[model samples]
Structure formats: C-alpha cells, structure tokens
Target: MPLHKVIYLSNNAKLYLWKITEDFDALFNQIRLKDSSLARLQTMKSENHKKGFLAVRMLLQHNDYNDFDLYYDAFGKPHIKPQGCSIKDVEISISHSNDFSAIVISEQKVGLDVEQIKEKALKIASRFMDVSHLENLSKEEQIKKATVVWGIKESIFKIKNEKGISFPNHIFEDDFNFEDKKATATLKFNNKEEKFKIQFDSEEDYIFVCAFESIKN
Candidate 1:
C-alpha cells in the first residue's frame, strides 16, 4: 500500500500516485486482472513493467473501481466505463516512471504523464521545446524545466490521442517561471486549435503532470 501521494486538482478531478516498493508476486496477489490484462502482463518483457501494471490496478481498487470497469480505445488510450445508467462517464489517464505509477480521473477529459528527471531530457529539449526557456537557469534547473515541458507535451498528446501530432510543431507551451508549477499550452492540429491547463510537481526524482481541456465560454 505504497500510495505515495494524492492531489485533488478539482472537485471532480484527482490524481493518484503509487510508489513501487512491492515485489511482483505481492502486487499480483492483491489484485485480480482480466484475461486480456493477464495476457498483456504475461507478454511484458520486464518485471518492472509488470509491477507497474499491477500497481495501477491497486490504485483502481483504492478508488473503488476495478479492472472490469476499465477499457482501451483504438488509439490505445485507457478509459473507464460507467457502471450504471445513472453514472457519469469518468475520464482517466495513466502514466508510469521508474518507481511510480499514476492515474488521473475527472468528469472532464484529462491527460497525465510521469517521467524521471534526467539529463537526456535537457539534451533533447530543443527538439520538442523552446531552448530559450532554459537560458539563465542552472544545469539542474534546466533538466527539471525541460522534463516538465516534455511532460506537458506528452500529457496534451494523451488528451488528443490523435495521429500526426508533432511535439514541437503542434504543441506550444506558454512561458512561465519554474516556481509557477502550472502553465497553459495550445494544440494546433487537424486545422483546429485547443487549449489545455497544465499542473505539474516534482516528487523525489520524478515529475508528474496533469492536463485538462480548457472550458470554452
């Protein structure tokens, strides 16, 4: 029960994070998986992935939902099915990093991503983000900021779940100070534009970001 942390973003949305401190068998014994999920788990090549997958189910159980309520779309996005006719649809987004797995649920469409902070993100920041944003920052700060930007793009991509969306060309994040911990971004794709509200934070050595579509007036 390494439920690391929980963030209540809004009345209708929240984020759940699990720190992977349990072994595979311990996690697997605590939750039941569907045939498809079991098959998928068996196919995973790494033990860490299996543990991450199981940890997600444990989170679902913590939230009172189970594997039976979850499904995936053609684009491979994960979702949850309302249990009854009176129940409202719940939007879900899942992400996993080195030692953490997270899920965000909301009445509105949402996207989430968790990534381990690393120098690689800084080295490749220019390809997907504005390099100017990294100037005037220490090397460590640069890595943190770049990782956040990358997470921002990835979260937006999860929300859209569309094809032909390039991180640099299609997604644009507004400039903000590192202290903000939140920002806005736009996705211009398929001849249309949409806006997103982003929230991010650093936990241990990883960064987790959540995105929600901006409400239109």
Candidate 2:
C-alpha cells in the first residue's frame, strides 16, 4: 500500500491520498469489510471503482478505523462512528480519480472532491461555472480553473448534502485567481444561505478540493 501523501488541513482536519498500486486481490486480501460493504463491492461494475473502494478502506485502516466503523445515510453520504472512548465526532468525505483515491477526515463539517484535469471540464464550464472567470486565461489555464470550480461546487454540495442543491443554480463560487489555491463559496438553497471556506491544490494530473463550513455561519 503506497500512501501517496498526507495533508493536515487544520488542527482537526487531515487529508489522505493513496496511489492505487496494488492489484484487486492484493487490496481485497488486506482489509476487513462488513457484509453490506462486501455486497456493495460486488455490484461495482468496474475494477477501477472496486480498487478505489478497497483503497478507501485501506485509508480508514491507516487512520485506525475499518469498514465496521463507517456507514452511509439515505443521501449516500459517508459517516464514521467514533470509538466509544473518544470525545470528538468524526466527519469524512471520499473521492477517487483515475489511479488515485483520497479521503478527508475532520472534526468539523467537511466536504471533499478530487477531479482529473480534462478538456471536457472546460467544454462544459458554462453549465456549472461562471464562464467570465475563465476569460483572459490560456486554454490550459481555463481547463484547470474550470475543473477547480467544478470541484469547488462538488465540495460544497458534499458539505451541505441537502435536497434541491443544484450545482449551477444553488452553489455560487466567489471569484478567485488560480495562483491562490483556495477560495470560498456560498450555498443558497431552501430559504436560507450558508458560507463555506474552500481550499484546493493540484497533485500530479488531478485537482483536490476540500471544503469546511465557515464558523460565521
């Protein structure tokens, strides 16, 4: 198991990235899975998704947890049951892109998304992002920026995990320069609004974005 990188986002939040170098059997043999998780893994249509799923369990194990401590809700959001002796609650988000799988664990409300850089993201930018933000930049820069913006929207959605949150209509990302590597977004849904603090960075050919609900909310 090659643990690619570990990022400490804040005092209570940390992110882990795993480069999927093991074969399916290798990964499968290493982690313990619950019955429901085993059934769910069997339904995954692609080996990449299975590898990503198993790799996430590897990450959980690295953090002293296993599949038994994890669960999902009706919305398909992942959660962790803290050890009985521990005082802090745990929040987690998971994402995978190509040969990489990543997870973010936090004591605060958090969301995370990782995306591979692709021209398609630029082509569909108008559907989910403010196109003007990509203006005056080179084509490659536009793709990177557009992908980051998409990731920003996804991260915010994961944090809120509420119904009727459309990426284009409900999530609004503030203007940001690519060099900053971080930004903020507002999720306006239902009849109220909340703000999120966002941080993003690139690794290899992928963009990783993490969101934390603003304390001011």
The parts of candidate 1 lying over 4 Å away from their true place are 83-85
Q: CA lDDT of each candidate?
A: 0.93, 0.93
lDDT minimum window of 10 residues, candidate 1: 81-90
**Which stretches of candidate 2 lie above 4 Å from their native place?**
none
Model 1 residue 32 CA deviation (Å) reads 0.6
C-alpha lDDT of candidate 1 relative to the true structure: 0.93
- Weakest 10 consecutive residues of candidate 2 by summed lDDT: 156-165
lDDT of 1 by residue, 33-113 (tens): 999999999999999999999999999989888998889989899999875674788899999886999999899999999
